[model samples]
Target: MLAIVSVTSPIFLLIALGFAAVRAGWIPREGALAMGRYALSFALPALLFNTLSQRPLDQIIVPAFLFAYVGGSLIAYALGLTAAAVARRTHPLDNAFFGMGVSMSNSGYLGYALISQILGAEALIAVAMSILTEVLLILPLTLILAELHDRRGRHGLARTLGKVVFQVVRNPIMLAIAAGLLFAALGWRLPALLGRTVDMLAGSAAAVALFAIGGTLAGQRLQHGLGPALAIAAGKLLIHPAAVLLMLFLVPAFDPTLTQAALILSGLPMVTIFPLLAQRYGLGELCASALLITTLLSFFTLNLGLWILGS
Candidate 1:
């Protein structure tokens, strides 16, 4: 229990401080968006490359963990959409936002911290996979859903595929993953100067991200759609983890390290990025509020999930 609090509290405290700063005008509101861009475009990708390139590909590609993480996300996304439709009277954009809020987690940030505390650095491969699943697989689908919601002129199936391809190509995390894989395949290592530089930048990612998340929470207000926001939070903290555990039986066993990693990753609350997506794409206030709610509730839910797994 102390381990949990020790790790989780510092991260949350930074977030809380960031939020208070934003509220008190100590930090400009615009700074959060810029920090977010740095996280998405540079820092996170550097971290992904450093982490994954160091892992043994054969051992890291655990089919069971993949199934649990990816399959659970798909199920949770669908359930969130269905719940939104039935309970919130939300429009397509709203539905997509709520679904994303529930299904997409802060896996890379929170997962790294929690798993490192309870598991260890050797579990880093599982954390890398968690990030890959969340950033690569789940994120694109959510973007497509948002596009579909906005009626962004689907030229054809091929065109839609092309756009997704373009988006993937443009995504820094995907690019880093691809580059890392290529280097790994060739048994290449980064030069010392470049590698150390990347290591330094990557190390700053979690702290900046947590601070930005808090700033985001400070900026959020439930200007509309409380019902959907609450529903999204419930889906994230409750249904998503439940889906993961339910699917765990169908999959093969991961190593204990990976198993613990998966549990912690799966139970993370909504990513701080969701609200940025909502605001950028015109999804609306409920989306951000949903994110805030899920993040705040995650302290309890993550502890419960870890206890269940450990027991």
Candidate 2:
């Protein structure tokens, strides 16, 4: 238990520091968001490019991990959506966003930061696989549900999903992945100065991303939506990780390191953009409160998860 705390303490402390800065007005909300954008668009992309470009194709592609993680996430999605459907007579559209909030992990910012601390460079590989599952499967599923519900049979789900795929392909991280794969395939290397620059940027990616997550979560009010918010947070912090762990066991023969990575990633709170995504459906307040609660509670839940995994 002490060892687990030793690994997770610095990570959460930095997050708390970022939260304190924003709430205390040391940094404005917009500035914090800008920090997130810089990390995602610049620092994280650089990191992905470096890791992907240098590693052989076999190391980066883990089919078993994808199957296990995606399957578990969908289980979470189904459960969250079902819970939403049974409560307060919400439209299926709103429920889709609820499902999304349950299923999507904060793979971009928090995932790498948490994993890298525990597993060192192995985080690069683990997080890469986890992000792919979110982008390729979980996100697309949520958008599809929303579109199908909104259009009420006017729009084809397949067509809507295709458009979502195109947009996802153009995401900054996905673009980085593509570029890195191209470089790896061609055996290309950048000039020395450019290489050094990328290395420096990559090094900053984890810390800045973690801080940005904390900043984005600041100032979310915790009233008026406590019931459903608490339910969603509980689902995210407990059911999601348990599902992933179960799926990993059923799948069999995965590397233990990647298996641990899958469990930790699943145990994370929902992506920070969860509220923004729900804002489109008018559920932002609920989602934001849920995000706050889940993140605050994760400090303890994650400790429990680490202990159970090790035990």
Candidate 3:
């Protein structure tokens, strides 16, 4: 519909602009990386903190929505891992990375930008909740699986688990979420000046993050690994959303907006760090190709998803 386009077009345009800028050499590769780092470390954390801190404790946690979203993601992850294990039958680490490609959603950058614009600031609670689930549960699980596959029992299970826990706690996004939730629970409010400063940083997150995503895509090689990449893309763009829909149906009562938000977020491409994580396991080529393919394909798929929801 025109209304949907009106809401989504600018967000895509910003992404396109970033893509073009990078492709045309308007922004150097290093600059794009720096921009992405800034968004991830500062802008996004500030935005999450601002949004979560101001919200009531109850609003920050939605059991039904979290259950549906996390359940769907786990199902998709399991399916992808099974398919990869069966098809390759040699590299368990690769299978774990493949599963990651299928399961992780680019919620922080693409999903947040789109949902905030389309659904407004109040809808951010859903986005935050999804991000929390990703940071806390899905990401660590996949990383541990991949690490275990790589180590092959050489490393002690306790040590591996401890390392993953440390990494998660040290993550700025997770720390920000924890801080925000604590403030909300304690009924603390930011001073007027500090609140305005946080808002200023948060306001820049969407555009910069999208632009960085575009640039990141521009930097990836998209020709190789087409076969497996396409399969992973299908899992991300189609199967993930379908899983979310199924879980939503299973949940007896849920916030309709949160349900819709979960679907949209599920339909997004894998998180921007997919390739970086894959690089550690030497699966970068496949994951990068899949990320690019899914991200480019998501415009049409997301539009279709929105249409389906509207109808």
Q: Which of candidates 1 and 2 is the stronger one according to lDDT?
A: 2
TM for candidate 3 is 0.97
Give the runs in model 3 whose Cα sits over 4 Å from its true position: 151-154
Model 1 lDDT tens row, 1-311? 66667666887788788889899998887887677678768887887788777766675567888889888888998888877778767777667776787788786666665666678778877777777787777777777776666654534556656787798788787898888777766778999999999999898888887777777778888786776678788988888878887888788776877877776777788887776678866665767778777788887777766667666
TM, every model: 0.92, 0.93, 0.97
- Residue range with the least summed lDDT across 10 consecutive positions in model 1: 151-160
Q: With candidate 1 superimposed using the best TM-score fit, by how many Å does residue 160's alpha carbon deviate from the native?
A: 2.8
lDDT for each residue of candidate 3 in 121-141, tens digit (9 for 90 to 100): 888988888898788888898
lDDT of 2 at 286: 87
In model 1, the Cα lDDT at residue 244 comes to 81
Per-residue lDDT of 240 in model 2? 91
lDDT of 2 by residue, 97-179 (tens): 77887889997788888888786776577788777888878888887787777734545867887888898988998898888
| Local error of candidate 2 at residue 10 (angstroms) | 1.3
